[model samples]
Target: MLFRQLFDAESSTYTYLIADHTTKAAVLVDPVLEQVERDLKLLKELGLILHYCLETHVHADHVTGTDRLRQATSCSGIVPDRAHVACADRHIKDGETLHLGDITITAIATPGHTDSHMAYLVNDDRVLTGDALFIRGCGRTDFQSGDAGTLYDSVTKHLFTLPDETLVYPAHDYRGHTVSTIGEEKRWNSRFAERDGRGANRLRHRPSFIEFMNHLNLPDPKKIMEAVPANEMCGHLAATA
Candidate 1:
């Protein structure tokens, strides 16, 4: 197995590249359009075949490189079915398996950040959590039709169920932290601590989570007005549109 975690400083986003060294086949998860040339160059230099560009959800913060990568590599574009992007080469449903040579990727429907958000479990060892789960703090549930309660359930119930040692790779982290484990997050995540501070026994984590989410007045992504529409079109922009 070949793996690399690439970062974009401007967006503070993490793009992943995974490949099966034996077959020289690879895929990029949550690719950013601005980094397309870099990603393409890496694939070419490594003598790898681009297989698929997998999006965790319809992101409002940054335009995706899926469309452009497809044009350059003939790789398929795979986005969550619920996103309704319509232009994706394939719409993957929950529990579906995606393959890269000998590697198998399973789609885990985690939702919350956006209704169709997904986290990919790579061969049961590492989970690509997208924006649904982050290090110490989860994604703000105040925008993009996000739901705090649902996100809480998705994390505590679904993601946390993975083995304590399972590696967590999130899509974005503003701070310098790069990775976390399921156990570490369950223990120290401030968002979870906030839920506990509300007295889980009385308010319950769900209600507290909802209240917490409602009160967070985080600003909208600076690029949402432009990025959303472009992402909806699979990250294509006409000179005039």
Candidate 2:
């Protein structure tokens, strides 16, 4: 398996190119619009054909390049079944697996950041966490049907159960920390550490949604409204042009 992790400094977003070296087939995860040209250029240089473009969620940050890339390269755009994005060629459900040459990617429905959010588990060991889990902190549950207790459950019940060594690659991070292991985050994350009890008790005592959002300090995603609709429609502007 060959992988390239690309970073956009402006939004602190990371896009991934996971490929099978033998087949020269690749898939992109959570791509940013501004980095589309660079991403496509690199793919061309690498002698690889893009098989799919995947989104973890409908982003509130930068516009997704999935539509433009799909039109440019004729690649399929894959997103969660619950996502209302029109550009998605395939709507994947939890436990659904996608084949990219020799590699297999599984979709895990991890709703907290947004109701339709997903986390892609790649090759069993690596996960594209989207905005759900950051290196040290988890995503804020204050917007777009975001709930603190739901987020807590998703983290402790769904994600934390993965192997301790599972590599966690998040979508954005303002801090320089690029990546971490499930075990590392499980032990060190302050939010999870403070939550007491299990199941009902955990949910009952969870922090207020407002309080949690306040601490997150997340800036409004640049041009979100413009970006989202365009992205959902598979780069409508780029497609038309």
Off by over 4 Å in 1: 194-204, 238-241
Show the lowest summed lDDT stretch of 10 residues, model 2: 197-206
lDDT of all predictions: 0.87, 0.82
Q: Write the per-residue lDDT of candidate 2 for residues 26-145, one digit (tens) a residue.
A: 999988888999999999999989999999988776778887888789999988878887657899999999887779999888888888888999999999899888997878776767
lDDT of 1: 0.87
lDDT of 1 by residue, 1-241 (tens): 8889999988899999999999998999999999999999999999999999999998888988888898899998999877979888888998999877778899999989888899999988999999988998888777777889889898888898899899999999998999999888877776764444555422236777788778988888998888888888788872125
Candidate 2, TM-score vs. the true structure? 0.89
